[model samples]
Target: MADLAMPEIALLGTSADPPTLGHQALLEGLLQHFGQVATWASDNPMKRHGAALDQRCELLKTLVESIADPRLQLAQDLSSPFAIATLERAKQRWPDRRLCFVVGSDLARQIPSWKDAQRLLEQCVLVIVSREGWPLEQADLQILRRIGASPRMLPMSVPGTASSQVRRRQTTEQLPKCLLPLVLKHNLYGFNTTNP
Candidate 1:
């Protein structure tokens, strides 16, 4: 019963346009670090991704289901422009859990400019997934530290795979294992199931 009361949660929010190997590694790593992993498919106002909001959310749900890891769970897209808003909602839902927000190094650097950035940083633990090509420099790391964000790093050799690259080259390139089926069936990322 003690386990039920322990607060351990981590949020891995992304567009997850189709999800990828990088996303998988990050989620798996988060699963190990926390009692529950909330994978959110958010729609960023800044960019138009491969899929729409609901489509991306559905893809996330599908990918999570395929992995079948009990530790990994899906969170609502919330359609909130601000990460702070989503964090607030996440806090309300998991009132008993210690919330941690996971971001890649690039996003980590951009956090300072996000809406209510400081509040978002203060709301929960910041977990940074330092990917292969985009290593976090000490200077940037210091910047985050200066902002009162002592982020924990989830180190892994995730290749420099971007969702944009996938969408652009979907016609000729190979799809990630987990996303292939959904991409094929739903014609996502402009993937042509016939040749794939």
Candidate 2:
């Protein structure tokens, strides 16, 4: 089929450290722009907590399963330190197509801190979802412009929910319904089924 030739993908750098509303909002925004969305669950030596590589991968599979669109899929990698590798792999897998890397504004704020950020930006279009209380800085925009990345901002209701906050809430606060299944399945955020 002609559909198979050009596969548009959006790579989400999710720790799945218990995927939260922030991650969901980012993905939903990307889903609107691309025909295909491939979420990347990475194994970063630097990350301290969240779902293990296999658990995060499985969670991504579960999340993708409910999507009705045939274009959406999940990809797993245990070696890629930067999300850019996902972009590179996507390009290699679908050389003739358009691909974009999806990220949250929170991460966008930290782009300069990432490994090989310039090279990453050069390879893919960036679809950055805006988060409340956090916006991209002039320096970030300058870097993005320098790399020729058409950075975009998408709006989503991702207020005070962050993985660390979620984790702390699990200790003393009730687990929100939307995050319950994922927390239980991944045993993340210190969420105990018996209590939370």
Candidate 3:
């Protein structure tokens, strides 16, 4: 008898300058839907400057260690500005497996305006995680359907965590327990080394 096909990989792209508990929660939730998750900090045009890519990767590594889940893999191999570019690269790395691109509802709304938007949609299955405040509209849903896009909306249970808010607070106690030391060690988001 023929063996079953390999499980698809969920490529979750983000600018996790400081990986939060909410982000961790989202990953845990994703495991229920997707086979496995490959998370990485890709370049989002909106937030250009913060803690550098290496720093972000290091923080993610720390969180992964704390979670101790083998399914969650950190993939910072591609730093492209276009979603399609990243999707293609993942294909190259894991040629035989399928790929699922996960994004927030806010990002989903903006995808229609991205570079090679239609091509991006075609590259992989799009999983839009619906968070509080940034809800998807009916028209946005209709556009996705009209464009021949492969998409699914998953409700994410996050604790109102935003990198912007973490930056403003500049307090490790305000962030995830696993992430606190990394932020302090790197002096991220304007954390004062001498003071902290």
TM-score top scorer: 3
Give per-residue CA lDDT, model 3, range 1-196, as digits (tens).
0112666888888788777766888888888877688888766776665788889888887776777788888887855777878887888898777777888777667888888878777767777887667777888878987776767777555555777777777656546687776777767898766656
Using lDDT as the measure, name the better of candidate 1 and candidate 2. Answer: 1
**Tens-digit lDDT string for candidate 1 (110-184):** 888788887777778888877767878888778788877877887555566777777877642434576677677
C-alpha RMSD by candidate, in order: 3.3, 4.2, 3.1
Q: What TM-score should be assigned to candidate 2?
A: 0.78
Per-model TM values vs. the true structure: 0.88, 0.78, 0.89
Give the CA lDDT, 0 to 100, for residue 79 in model 1.
40
Ranking by lDDT: 3, 1, 2
Query: CA lDDT of 167 in candidate 1?
Result: 80
Lowest summed-lDDT stretch of 10 residues in model 3? Answer: 1-10
Off by over 4 Å in 3: 1-6, 193-196
Error of 3 at 60 (Å): 1.3
Cα error, candidate 1, residue 159 (Å) = 3.0
Q: Candidates 2 and 3: which is better by TM-score?
A: 3
Report the lDDT tens digits of candidate 2 across residue range 53-133: 777666656655654367666666422767666666777776776666777676776676677777777777777776777
Question: Comparing candidate 1 with candidate 3, which one achieves the higher TM-score?
Answer: 3
The CA lDDT at 132 in model 2 is 72
